[model samples]
Target: MAFEGGERGTTDERLTARLRTGVGERLGTSDEHDTLVGVLFCLPNLVAFSIFLLGPVLYAFYISFHEWNILANEGTWIGIQNYVAVLQPAPWANDWAPLTDPTANTFWYSLKTTVVYAIGTVPLQIYGGLAVALMLDKRVRGKKVYRAAFFMPMMLSGAASAVMWRWFLAADGIINSLLPSFLEHNWAGDPGTALMGVMLMAVWGGIGGNMIFFLAGLQNIPEELYEAARIDGATGWHRFRHVTWPNLGNTNFFVIVMAIISAFQVFGIALVFSQGGPYYATTTTVLLVYQRAFEEGAMGYGAAMAFLLFCLIFAFSYYQYKNRDQAEVGY
Candidate 1:
C-alpha cells in the first residue's frame, strides 16, 4: 500500500510539471515576447498620433521660423523674424504700454484679451461647478434629472452654443428683454460688454462639464470618512471643510488646470459671438492667430503665435504637474 501511494504521488507531480511547462510554452513566457506584444498593442495609437498630431506640430514649428506663403505651399527661411515681428511693440508706440497705447502691437492686445478672458472665466467655472456639484451630490428628488439638465449644455458643439448665445445677447434678444430699461444694452455689439458677453456664455456652457468632473470625484470619496466626521459631532460646514474639501484636492486641481487651458484657447465663442469686434475688444490670441493665418495670410507669423501659445500652455501644465503633490489629498 505504501509503494502504491508513492507511485501515485510521483505520477501527480509529473502531471503538474507537464501542465506548467505546456502553459508556459503556449503563453511565450519571455521578456522579449511580452515587449513585442506590448509594442503591437500600442502600434495603432502611435501611428495615429504621429500622423495626426506630431506631424502637424513639427510642420508648424518649421513654418514658424520662415516666411511661409500659403498660396505657394512653400517657405522662405527667416530665422525667428516671424517671432520678432509678433513680439516687437509697434513702431508708433512712444511707451511700452500695450494695454493703453492705441497703436500698441496687435499681438500684445490679443494676448492681454486672452489673459483677461482666462482670469474672468476660470474662477467662475471652478467655483460654480463645485457649488452645483455639492448641491447635486445630496439626497434630493430628481437628482438624475437635474444632473442631466445641467450637463445638457456641454453636449452642444462650441459653434452651436456660440450661435445660441449670440441670439440671446443680441440688442433685442431675451437677455435685454428681461433686463430693466436702464440696465439693458447691446451686450455683444458694445465694445465694453462684448468680451463680457462671451465670458458669460463660456461660464454657462463650461460649468456643466466641470460639475460632472467634480461629481465623479465626489462619488469616489469613501463614505466612512463622512460617517466618522458625523460621529465626532462635526457640523455640515466643518465636515465639508475637513473631509470633503481635502478629498477634493485632486479634482479641484484638474478642473482649474483644464479651465485655464480652455480659457487661453477660447476662440469659437468669441469668433461667433462678436467676430472679435467692437474695435478688437474680444480679439483673443487664438482668434488673432486665425485672422493672421487665414484672413491676412501671414502664415509664419500665425505659426509663431501658435508656437508661443503652445509654450505657454506647456509651461503652465508642467508647473502644475511638478507641484501635483500639493494638490493631492492624503487619507
Candidate 2:
C-alpha cells in the first residue's frame, strides 16, 4: 500500500472496479455490489449447461470409441472401428447384412431420402408460415383466434400427430374419401406416394409455429419504416424489399434453421406412417440410429451414425450461417 493511500482505500477501489462493468451496472443498486451479484447469478446456468449438455455429449463420444452391445453386455476397445463400419457398410460377417449392418452399409440411400424430405418440407413450411403470419399481422376479424387455431398443431404431441396423420394418409381415410373417389386411393401404402405423404404431414404440422415466429418478427418492424419507404415512392414489393425484409433477417435465420433441423430429424412420422416404408425409403438418419442402437442391438454402430448426424447438422448450420449473411446483404 502506498503511504498516501490506506489499506481500506485500496480494498474499496478493488471492490468498485469489480462491481462496475460495461453493461451490467444496472444489476446492482450501487455499482460495486451489482457486479458480484450478477456474476454469481450467472454461475448456476453455466454449471448446469456443462453438467447436462456438454457432459453427455462428451460421454457419448467416449462410448462411440468402444464396441458396446448393451443387451449382451459385451464391448471391447476398438478405436474408430465403429465409425469405419458405419461409413463403409461393405460386406460384413455372417450375421451382419448390408442393410442391417452398421458397418459396410449403404446408408447413403437413407441420407438421400432425408435430404429429399428436408428439401421438400422446408420451403413449403416457410412459405406457408409466412403467408399465414402476414395475414395474421393484418387487421383481420378474430385474428387472435385464427392465430391460436393455426398454432394448435404445433402444440400437439409429435408422436400423437404422427399417429393421427397415419390414419389420415392411409387408404380408406378422409383424403381418399374426398379424392374423386378414384385418385385418392392408398397414398401411404404406395412407395411412390408414401414419402411425399410423410413430407406433407410434417409441413402441415409444423407451419403454424413458424408463422407465429415470423408474425412476431414482422410486427416488431417499425411501421414508420414502411411509411418512409412509401413516401419515397416505393411500391409494396419495393417497401418490403428495402425495409421490412431487411429488418427480419435474424428471425428468418432462426426460422430457417429450426425448420431445416426439424425436417432432417423427422422420425416419428416415418415410424407411425411408413415404418421404413414399402422398403427402407423413408428411413431417416435418426430412425436408422435408433434402430441400430435399440432395435437391432448394434450400440457401436448406432453411436457412429449419431456422430455422423451431428456432423451433418453442424455442416448445414454452418452453411446457413454463411448464406444468411449473404442474404442480409442482398436484402
- TM-score winner: 1
lDDT of 1 by residue, 1-331 (tens): 1244468789989999888778879886865777898999999999999999999999999999989899999989999999988888753464657765424788887888889899999999989999999999999999999999989999998889888988988899899999999988888889888889889989999899999999999998889889988999999999999889888888887898999999999998888878888899899999999999999999999999999998999999999988876744544
Stretches off by above 4 angstroms in model 1 are 1-26, 90-94, 326-331
Query: What is the C-alpha local distance difference test score of each model?
Result: 0.88, 0.80
Minimum summed lDDT over a 10-residue window in model 2 is located at 95-104
lDDT of 2 by residue, 192-223 (tens): 78888888888888889889889989988878
Off by over 4 Å in 2: 1-36, 72-74, 89-106, 326-331
- Tell me the number of clashing residue pairs for each predicted model: 0, 6
Error of 1 at 72 (Å): 1.2
> lDDT (0-100) at residue 50 of candidate 1?
100
